[model samples]
Target: MLSHLEFSGFYFIKNLHFGELGFVQSAQGFIFLSGLLVGLIFMKRHERAGAAQVRRRLWGRALELYGWHIGILLAILALSRLMPDSWFVWNRWLGRLYDGGDVYVAAAAALLYQPSYMDILPQYMAYLLVSPLLIQLIATGRAAWVMAGSAACWLAVQLGAHMPLVALLDGLWMGGATLQPRAAFNPLAWQVIFVSGLVAGALAARGELQPRRLLDPQRPMLFHLAVGGLVFFLAWRMAITTGLIAPEVLERFQAYENRVEFGLVFLLNFVALGYAVAWLLVAGQRSASYGLRVGATLLNRLLSHPFLVLIGGYSLQVFAWHVVAVYLLRLVDWHVGPLAEPLNSLLAVAAIASLALPARWLASRAPTRLADAPQPSRS
Candidate 1:
């Protein structure tokens, strides 16, 4: 559903004219879940290998990501040169991305070169680069101090005190404008989330998180309903009382504020929403019906095997296709039939499905050396 929604260009719920908060909620849930999973994976690895080993591995991955990013830039440059008169126009879109100044902002979103998923790879690399420092800070058992320190750094950036080192590595783009409270993708702002992930990872590694045993099946439906109502009311009332109830604010809260340098309030929302989603998934796994099971299986499969489930596990190919399509559309400046939107959507989906097949096939076939392992003889 999310894959379809994304390709269909329904990023924001409001874009679909839906007053319901489901879309934003789902997106936030996904992002927060991603962070949690990242933390869990790394923390577990860290525990097994010790911080030194984990840090070394992560550093290698970070370097690989940097190389990959440069490769992406090269590919974009090559494609542009090769197809000089092709259907797409990269220059205009890139210009818009530089300043958020574009007339067709909606159409050429990916093409415009904003800090989206592709760009987010580098953002994640930034966090990985600083992983050891963040891990050490959190390990000191002074999470509060770390948060405060992160906040201070963010404030410095907001004050336009640029960190040249990070800029040299991650490039000049910071999160959405407004530096105060240091929200957004700027390393200064994002340290909070990265640290938070580290803390969460540490907690998870210690097996400190309580399992979802409280939501037993014996619990009455009314009890669950009442609790849900209470949460909703509290969220709504708090928003109203604070007078920061804008769509962006609501969206952030719904998603878990890990937005691309989104605001502080939004960031808080990100945390809240993360907990909410975690709770929901826990409860749902235990209490939901067969339909939910089927739906979840599909969703999990797609997320787990994105390349196989959607197209090919690589979203880059899909993205590159979109860029080419946009270029074509712009070349003729043609907005002619219904076919444009529908066909584009179908093609994207098809790309995802087709790519998934090859990816799955490749994954299934392991190299003989990797598959070979010495067996221990039984006494």
Candidate 2:
């Protein structure tokens, strides 16, 4: 949400771009973690119930996401129509919707015309739609095959195979409009992260993978390497952001850092950072070192705060609301131009605080049976 606010021109803190902090951004984590949780929860569901239940639940989730996508787009369209086009500063993606007429609307409804920040939900929908098949493979002890296929798909995308596929699909349906290939994030390239998480979660669910083993005191080398890689990436990011590095030098590395394709740098950084954090948390609870234990306790407490937990519990609702908040903030920027300090920072914090509204509302109205249902362990 903070990242979205920053992207929407809310400079909550000067020179602090949350989205640009390192090689990997929150979106990668979000996608990977979502896949992880889905894999863990639904695999358990499949075991207890059956494949039918998994299909039903996952398809229902896809439908809910589809509804939210269309509803959000409609809300944005309504707001755009109500505001004067000359006065509003529209993002290029949203602007295409305003100008492209009904064809764009139809395309968006079909999930082929995702617009900027609005794209991720559609990607999630696609993943959820195919999740049953993925889950079946994982459950049947073919997870290695599934992972290999996912990696192959990601590699194919990196080699530019997805481009022609997108072009072909567009040609079949878009006439000459050229919108199908314009998604902000390519699912093909990004699925590797999701599948990696899925396989790990499935293994963890089945007692084949013990996450706590990541903190084994004997693995000091792994811990040290993770810390070293994290520090290097942090320094590299700081250099670029703080102008300590030459632009041309950074430009040469841009290909490996491509956000659209889920580049190599991001994959490596996420792995290192993820392992370090996991080890820290696991060690915080079970480590022999007192100082490390105390530090981990503090970190865990901060992460597990009730307010954060509430937002996490209704993550989908919060995510949807965040997108709405971002678009609405853009509308505000359209009228006021760029906001000055204090005001900008104030609005930014308030926008983040407002994310809890949907979560709270949903919590209040949550069905009793659903609320009481057994949840998968975060451990």
Candidate 3:
């Protein structure tokens, strides 16, 4: 449900341009859920197979993501060309992504140098590539080291460090090769969120995680944490709006990070928002009707309707379609101005309900003999 909301929110944020509250970035939850699911699934796979097989399976998943990432970029590049003086505004800067001579290199190395709004997929690929090591660390009972290492990487990047993958690729590309993305989501920084979710999922798979982790309303510490987080976030927003400069660069950067920065405020809101959502979901999961006019059963049914279920199930396909749709919508706004708003809204709904069919069709056409483990959906 959060994933669906986050995907929906992207449309609102991009079109209306204002959903950057402390706890509102849905991608954080989405990615975390992806990690969580992977953790759960990987544990199951490991039990059925072995640690080495789990490693191979994860790398295979990364390779699958790699293919999808490349496919989307290729589509975007083609669309960028197809839209130019004709209609959309995407043509204005799409060519800027690569040098003429470096086009092949850039396309080939898309994982290293993604365009703006395309950072998240590559980050997933990067994390998945190294997930075996992470899972091993946990499987071996070195979770503290996992936390320490993840936090260290995040803090280092937060303190101005960049990933070295781009730097390594610089040797091949002609002209200057700045390895960092156009807009950096800082995967190193985000590992903590994903890994934490991964740990939670793994624990749950092992029957170790408990609902009481968040369900205990009597826990004053948790209440204080939520209150303090919300207060600080709201206060920070007020301060910036009122023209009080932030005390530090990081604090200011979090205000306008291209996507959600997995920092303190994000963690706080994640926990608080997660608690609230989980509580609602648990309450709603019950089939028994409460006193409400629109009971939990109906709400749950709405949540599980074909459209929402399929969208959440085939989220990656929906996401790729979303990128293309957003760009095309921008084009419509450029030329067919009056139709843009209504068209965008229509696209959002159609995107959720219709994308899965094409995705299913494509999957049916795909080679069947290849052995890739089940996809761990973000939702």
Instruction: Output the number of the TM-score-best candidate.
Output: 2
Reference-based lDDT, residue 25, model 1? 37
- Candidate 3 lDDT, 259-328, residue by residue in tens: 4346566666667766545544554343233532144456567778876665676678778876776566
Prediction-by-prediction clash tally: 21, 0, 1
lDDT of 2 by residue, 180-205 (tens): 54577888888888888888887889
Show the colliding residue pairs in model 3: 88-331
- Candidate 3 stretches greater than 4 Å from native: 1-23, 84-88, 91-95, 98-100, 103-110, 161-180, 217-228, 231-261, 283-305, 338-379
Give the per-residue lDDT of model 1 (tens digit) for 99-145: 34442233223222432233444556666777766565555566567
Q: Each prediction's Cα lDDT score?
A: 0.49, 0.80, 0.63
Please rank every candidate by lDDT, starting with the best: 2, 3, 1
- As a TM-score, model 3 comes out at 0.74
* Candidate 3 lDDT trough over 10 residues, lowest sum: 1-10
lDDT of 3 at 180: 34
